[model samples]
Target: MTYSKTWQGFYELLDTVYRTGRPFAARALPIRLGDEEADRAIDLLYQPLRDGEGAVTGIFVGGYDVTEQVRSQAALRDSEDRYRTLLDSLDVGFCILEMKFDEADRAIDYRIAEANPAFARQTGADVAGLWVSEFAPDLERHWFDTYGRVALTGEPIHFENQADVFGRWFDVRALRIGEPAQAKVAVFFSDISDRKRMEEALRVLNASLEAQVAERTAERDQIWQASTDLFCVATLDGRLASLNPAWTTLLGWGEGELLGRPFLDFVHPDDVAATTAAAAGLARGEPQPNFENRYRHRDGSYRWLSWNAVPRNGRIYATVRDVTAVRAQAAALAEVEEALRQSQKMEAVGQLTGGVAHDFNNLLTIIRSSVDFLRRPELPEARKRRYLDAVSDTVDRAAKLTGQLLAFARRQALSPAVFDVGEKVRGVADMVDTVTGARVRVVVAVPDHPCFVRADLSQFETALINMAVNARDAMDGEGTLTLTLTCGTAMPPIRGHAGSQNAFAAISLADTGPGVPPDLIGRIFEPFFTTKEVGRGTGLGLSQVFGFAKQSGGDVDVTSSPGRGATFTLYLPEAPAALEADDRSAAAASVSPIGAGESVLVVEDNIEVGRFCTQILQDLGYRTTWATNAEEALERLGPDGAGFDVVFSDVVMPGMGGLALAHELRRRMPTLPVVLASGYSHVLAQDDAHGFELLHKPYSAEQLGHILRRVTRPGRPRRTA
Candidate 1:
């Protein structure tokens, strides 16, 4: 063939081909089949020629009838390129494994085209065209068997297999690359070590979390069971659903008795309304801050209950506190406080009476003595009768006035005796209905058996009546009044210690009425303190009970809150059968006249008292001396004066009180008899009878005579008779 290329251009093209070392093709624009043809056909291709030294020599137009062969070669090259690209780009380890049946059906051969980076890194060896048994001997059986199955059956196999290669792992699949047993089987493998590590880590974390939850659950159970506060779960319908040990213990009920039962079954009837309201609020998801109510115990006694709860897990989880003991203590404390306040008021009143009595006794002494001298039997009988009548009138007026003062002071001369308390409770109950009118129901639950206490019968009845009256006032003649009398072991004194433990009776007066006024409730027991109109009450009822109870080794208590009625309880020492029945004979009889040869010393700050005492002593056949105060008495008993046989001194003189003078006088005349005279009971100091004779003043000449005879006469017992 002839070519148009110049010699230099031809050599240049040849150099280019030789330098690049790649195939190149070119084509002409068109070809014409004319009759005249050239001596050669041109080949539009570039090629390089090499010389003996292996250097590129020249471009050559070496034409031949090789069109068919050229097309075939080009096609082969294109397929080879595609195959090489696939081998390089694949991620799975592609090994063209050949199964073999040797001496045993085990040994295998591996003629890999090329392995990916994954397979190369796993084995740490370039393993193309390697025997399968030599490269990985342990995998010979499994690999050949899997490869054989897939290659022969034209099926794909997916399974897990392990390899002890770099970063050891499990591989997933084996499949045939081509059709039939003659073809290479592809075994695809991946390093799954990282995935396995992640799974193991997750398992350990789950175990730890489960352990933590178990521990927390155990702790919660322990708290629920061991706590003193009752822990419980209730349904929305206010049924007792579940409870801990504390609930049963506190309520004194068995588990069977409480579970699935309505909570209201155990509530105090009077408190049910408020409890129902609180439960309703809780059901509506209201956060009730510590709800308070009362629950009836198994013994039919009511106890206070306080509770707080939360709604969670479709149930009400709650903590209940049996505040009965605390409530009782608080009630007892309030009662004690009320009693103490009342007692203080009574003491204050007594102090006022004492001051008045100190002055009044002197005046009474003068009058009594003048009246006594007028009846000396030296005058006519008619005139003497008139004088005696006048004396009688004076005595009657004085007795009435003194009685009022004693009532106000709460320390009248009471003769306490062993008797049934149930009668008094009933007596008060009978009057309660009359006083409270038809609007109130009065129930007297007095015990049929004797519930006994040692209290003055009159005072006891009066206290009961007072409480009933107060209840009537509170109810405004409406609602129910319950007077309950029961006996029990002695409780600690409602106030201070009332001796040691003693048999006691509890008289409870409960009223369903308007509660005490919130503001004035605390001060109701103050002297002259009243909730009624001026004519209705003197306000000394509670105060008198307070003093009388304490003095008799007992206490009085009361409770009232807003919107709730009032309850008053009296706790008194039970009279013992062994003790003398309150010495009733002592309550009777007037003061006795003085016997012969008793010398008396009269000490007073008031002029009228001193002079009268002198006259009475002389009239009673006793030598008498008078002194204005303790100082004057001490001087009169000094070396200049002959000492009297007995010293009669008035407490509360100008310079010193009677106790101090007694201390002073007893220093010199320790054995000499001294009697302290006062108009009122001794409410000044803790003890008015501290190692001396105490004479309640406002006594007649006859009383003066008795005091002297009782002290001065030998082998004589002390008595007013």
Candidate 2:
């Protein structure tokens, strides 16, 4: 009879029958059992069937699960094929165990069910169907415990051993083959010796790498300590974080003393603002160029430092070099530059003076002649008075012109002494209120403490007032003038010259005026250059201030931009003195009576000036001789020319200047009195009675007499020609 089940399933059902009375037909279908190992089917075919007539009849039919019997046979054959496949194809070792019972009905041993050839390689045993514990007695204590547990529990147990086994590490997995009550367990193992050895090697390598890192770190620390430059780290707010030993050695501060202090505390107080700003910028990730500033050393003195700063990883890193010597050299360079500039300026002025005097003296000659002719008794008193007044006014104009020239040339003399600049500025504040009209507001920002400077008191005050007036004009007489005194003790050297050292004190005069035109700022201090209309300004105001400051051993600088108002800085070298109002000069408003008598020697390259000088002296009742040059004057003094009472020489001439002549005369005659006349500052400074008395040019008859009197009368002595 045909069954509606697979052949294997039909066989499985037949195996279950014990007292079956009939044969049956069944249906069968295929079913999977193990991965690539077995298959099964089920069917209802079993025993034989009988008919009612007592003879065998048609067999009974039923659908049955016959999958297992068919599958079992297939599996056995497949297992043999797999056994060969595993032996040739698997990379890892494989083993199988079979159950063996003892005579008392207890499992006493286990046999090799079937194993691929690799099992022999794992263990040197060739015998099949034998107990693993017996074959390898060394594994009895080890593998037996896990094997028995698995065999009874029907669960898998996996183990690993990096210890050399058969010359290599091995990992094994064991499991029971049947139910929990089974005595057979299969164990599989593989070799992983290479991975284990590699791991151990890597651990050693990591330890070596750590040691090398430590060595490198020590070397780097040694190098850092040996370096000469000062390296430091600070917070964004300029609080010191870390510093090298060099900082303490060079700066005289102990490490512990420097820590937790504001980095700017070690900086000169005046430089704190700049240092703070730079640090803040660095903290915000902005790099700083090598900027010069002042820092306080362990001693109570300040020194220069130049440094570059950058912020890295939330910390400020700065490398600094002591720049005090460099700064000093730079200051010296600046002084040299200033000297050169002054020399060139003086040369130009001297040339201008010579040219002007040569040309203008001829005109003066005619004017003097006309005036002399008019002074005769024939002319009416009214016309005579008018002519006299006209001549006097013309002479005054010439004098004023010369004075302006002197201001430009910086030749005008200044009586210098120490004075308090703060009080001087304050004194001007009250005057500014009236000069600039009530509409203008003036505030003096002078410090309470004394700020002393060595300079010409009148000139300094005059320069400051001039600056204020200019500021007031810029503001149309309605703005503020703030005079602030700032200490410049630690200012960096300027213009690479020690002489160009920033003044010890700075008096800044600022105004809220419409700012100066950028184009005019540079030229404002030039003589006769002005922004005001023709009639409004002489343009000599700033030139005078500039000349005065330079002559007084100081400088003037201006900062201005369109719409930003303006500030004028008067940098005056400091002197130890009280910073209060100083006394005014006693001769400030003196009439200065002219001198009479005494023989005079006048040297003028221009014939007209020579004659004018001779005539003026003669009219004043003094003996005199005129020379066109130094050579002619020397001859006059040597007895061939007229005997001289006192020598007066023009600075610029065809042969030699008055300064050189004066020095030569000082050597020749020793006590021979000489006077130097110039319209330029270079001439005046060239010899400050390093040889003879200095006299500025463009003098009137009265001025000429006055200087002569002052020179002739030393300690109240006088002479008559």
Candidate 3:
């Protein structure tokens, strides 16, 4: 029989069964009945009837329709596939776990059975089909306990917790998936470690901020209560808003009395205006670091207050201190300074008096003794001449003593002339080597160019000698003295005087000797202030140097260190080098001393000195005329000074001083030579002689004769017949 018309699948099955001599069955096999558009599914079975040899056979089939069942199964599988895909796509992790139980029925461990892709990411590991104990053996027991309880009781749970073994925190939801006997759970979780860490940092920061705020408050309170200076806060309108306890302690005013009142009310009447001005400044946001004013105290007295204040947020924060004691101390210091100056002056005077008495008495002793010896009637000619020479030498010594005193006073007459400082220093170096002894070496250092200064040549040389002698004494005559000359330099501040930026010539003498002691350096220029033994020095050397430097428009400074050495620098204002040639020419053309009956008009206030001066001029081959005063001398000159070749006048005469007389003569007789003589004259000391020749008192007959002869030199401007 052919079943191909009924169902192709059945026909095929029957054919196979017939060929194999077996019966066949089919399930859900599609067939068309009577040419229908849709085919029907059926379950069929085929069996074949076989002969004894099992070769040829006829087949029989059994069948049933199964279209609905097949379709339902397909639909269910499609829905399951979709559910798996949804789980895999979620950000949250999802997994199914099968719990393992021990003999006591307690869930001990779990194996991951099913997982989504997110499960591996959230857990930082792919644990599917692996026991939790195998991967995370150090997992906390609480995890097992919580998940096991949920599975056993079929209870769902939601929690956020750290899994220490995984080093992460999780937000987890777990529920039993089936019957409690199944011991299975479905878990949904997400990694929450970053959220947890941020929360923890915020918590720590909040705690620290609170602690810092409390600490600052405590510190402010401590400073407010403990500070001795008055601390206060005031409004812009000048009312005291708050005050520290220092106010009560310092001004004897209670806090209540001072608060909420205009601060100017406590100010002194004389200081109220100033205090108001200061308040205005503070309101403008100006900081007043040190403003002083007086405040009325509770004791009916006024106290000086110094305020340091700043403005912020329409308020003034101020710190004030009582400065009454400071003011009083400053006044007292002023008085003390005056007293110290007076004491220093008196001490200097005492030293001068002692020195003068000591030196003069010695000189007077020689004179007195020599005069006494000469007074003997039977004195030999040789002895008489020796006594006369001794008297003359003593007089010379007295005059030198007076001159040194006058030099220290800056009251000695000076004849300033321009000369090269380098050449002068070099010249002094030779003498310094001799004065310092053979054991001491002298070094002279000078620049190639000339440095000149206008100063008294004699005084300048004397100052150099004094310094050299001082250096030798300091070295004990066994060290080196370096003389350095620098041109085009500036004066540095010395002895508290201001420095000069003007060009200057610097002459420095450095000595390798035991240096000046720090304590004595300041007073080294004080007259009679010496470190030497009593008979060794007169102590006027450095003093004369100081006076000379000051009077010559310059300064002297010394720098020293103990056990090292000392350097003394003399700074003089630089003069033009153009004067050097003129000085040299003048020095070259100097005249001889022997006079040849030159007429001299002598003006002297003392009759004895007048007579003596005339006699000396007459003996020097100069015809002399005497006048008691400048007027008499002018009258003797007869308005033109015609008869006199030179006017030898005392500088400190009674009226119309020598300087005035010289000016008068220059006006009347411009060609007549004027020679000024003075032992000590204020006019000569303070001002120059206006081109008049100067002859110092106590000058030797040779000196007087020389100056007169030079002024009377023929063919010279002042050398008229």
Per-residue CA lDDT of model 3 for 598-663, tens digit only, reads 888888989888888888888888888888999988877886565678888888877698889988
Model 2: residues with Cα > 4 Å off, grouped in runs = 1-438, 441-462, 485-503, 517-529, 538-540, 547-553, 560-564, 575-596, 639-644, 685-691, 714-721
In model 1, the worst 10-residue window by lDDT is: 198-207
Top-TM-score candidate index = 3
lDDT of 1 by residue, 1-721 (tens): 2334343255565656878865455543122224435322234577666789877666655434444444444544543443333334333354556555445443354556445565686567888767656666666355566666676676766655556444466555555543463555655565566542110000000012322433333423533453455656688788988777776666678888889999999888888898888878778877455788887767777768777665543566565656566677788999999999899868877855664575357547756875877868687888777777766666665654454346445555554557777776777667667767888788889767777776667777767777787888878877888888778656554434543466678888898876877687666655446678865765666666666666666777777877889888888877654344544235323335665765566888889888887887788888777788888788877742254677788887777776687777777767677888876545432343565766655677776676667666666432220
- Judged by whole-model lDDT over C-alpha atoms, candidate 3 comes out at 0.79
What lDDT score is found at residue 486 in candidate 1? 71
Which structure among the candidates has the greatest lDDT? 3
Candidates by lDDT, descending order:
3, 2, 1
TM-score of each: 0.36, 0.42, 0.61
Model 2: per-residue lDDT, tens digit, 473-550? 888888777878886553333334345555467878888987888778867887666788756666767877777766
RMSD of each: 34.6, 32.8, 27.6
